[model samples]
Target: MKNFNWTNIRLFLIVGVAVFLYSFSGIRNEGRKIKQAEVVFVDNENFITKKDVNKLLKQNFDTVTGIKKVQLDLNKVEKSIDTNPMVDKAEVYATIDGKLTAIVVQKKPVARIFSGSKSYYLDYKGNEMPLSESETARVPLVSGSIDRTDKKRLSELLNYIYDDDFLKKNITGLAVMPWGDIMMDIRGYDFEVVFGKPINIDRKFKNYKAFLQDAIKDTLTENYKTINLKFTQQVVGTKK
Candidate 1:
């Protein structure tokens, strides 16, 4: 009975020692220093580069390398990258093998707005996006007396034009009048388009298409000075 009791006590001590050693090893691994970081853009666009993300990450940690894995505030690191105007979203994580990774998504600009001398891009979200030194987006340009409140409508209008291949290839510029009216310019055509208010977009576009198809079929596309779609149910073209 004495020998059996001793064996049970020895087994318990052995198990306890093994558990302590395992936990110690895990703790030590958690303290391992990060050796490198990699930034990946989901869209693969260079509007925001890896160097830019590295700078943003450094803003939080000075230098991310050589820091213990458990000491990094990943949420703060992600938030830092989110502050960039070009970034739409960002996610950051640390690997067990001492590598840090950040995945970034960038905003998409639909039109470049030129209000007076101030120029900026209007993104798909209807927000102003600053131009990048990396690359210029090949989007339509908007000019004239643009009201701040009209941004959402303008963005929608630009999106509609961009989605249609015919309109996207022909329409190059838009102008907002002081009285809240809109105008458009077509590529390779010497005519102005009276777009009017941004409502009834589908109907207006359909009417314009009918007019355009007839004008092209008749070989009189350049015979017009202005095409008006503001009138109800019809597109009015004024001969030059």
Candidate 2:
């Protein structure tokens, strides 16, 4: 007869009990009520507030407290939060302590476009964002009858303008003429600049910088009504 190994049987029984307890604990926790919710914004930009997030959560996942974990549609709640125009991203999750958490990211606007049908903002990702009455983003303003086809180039131009501190501060408005020409309105100047198309941006800006440096030295910036950048070799000036 083979000797019975009591140690092996004891070890197996202990492991089985541990696993059973762990599974029971998980089942109990799953049925536990959700205690509270926490809404956290990624940054303090205030483009979307905690109050706004709570309001949205209330709309989709109302009073989740006292409700079981398996009952809440977390994916649907996240999708609902993401549907807001101002929100760029939303992450929803439930903690082991029965607390729900949502992290939201707001869209950052690059420029404000004044279209004929509506006024909207162009975000950093080149998407249209609706203007908020509570907050005003001081970005470059693109004013004119800008068609949908022209928005991409115009957004690129605005992003370039935004990248330069001098341009962002001095160039206030961009007007797209009916003939497809782009004119930039300079701040504190009576005249406008004809920036032409969106080609050879580096060369054009370099020429423009040199011309501006010389013009400022000669105190002739106010003398010209338009500074043309259409030509490759020369910065043309049409005097008032």
Per lDDT, the best of the predicted structures is: 1
Q: Relative to the unseen true structure, what is the C-alpha lDDT of residue 198 in candidate 2, on a scale of 0 to 100?
A: 62
lDDT of 1 by residue, 123-222 (tens): 8888889999998987889988888326677778888987889998889898888888899999999999999988788889999998898999999988
Q: Which stretches of candidate 2 lie over 4 Å from their true place?
A: 1-25, 217-219
Error of 1 at 135 (Å): 1.5
Clash count list over all predictions:
0, 0
| Whole-model Cα lDDT of every candidate shown, in order | 0.88, 0.83
RMSD of each: 4.5, 3.2
List pairs with backbone clashes in candidate 2.
Answer: none
The weakest ten consecutive residues by lDDT in model 1 span 147-156
Candidate 2, residues 86-156: lDDT per residue as tens digits? Answer: 99989999888999899999888888888786889998778989987668888878876576236667767
Per-residue error (Å), model 2, residue 84: 0.7
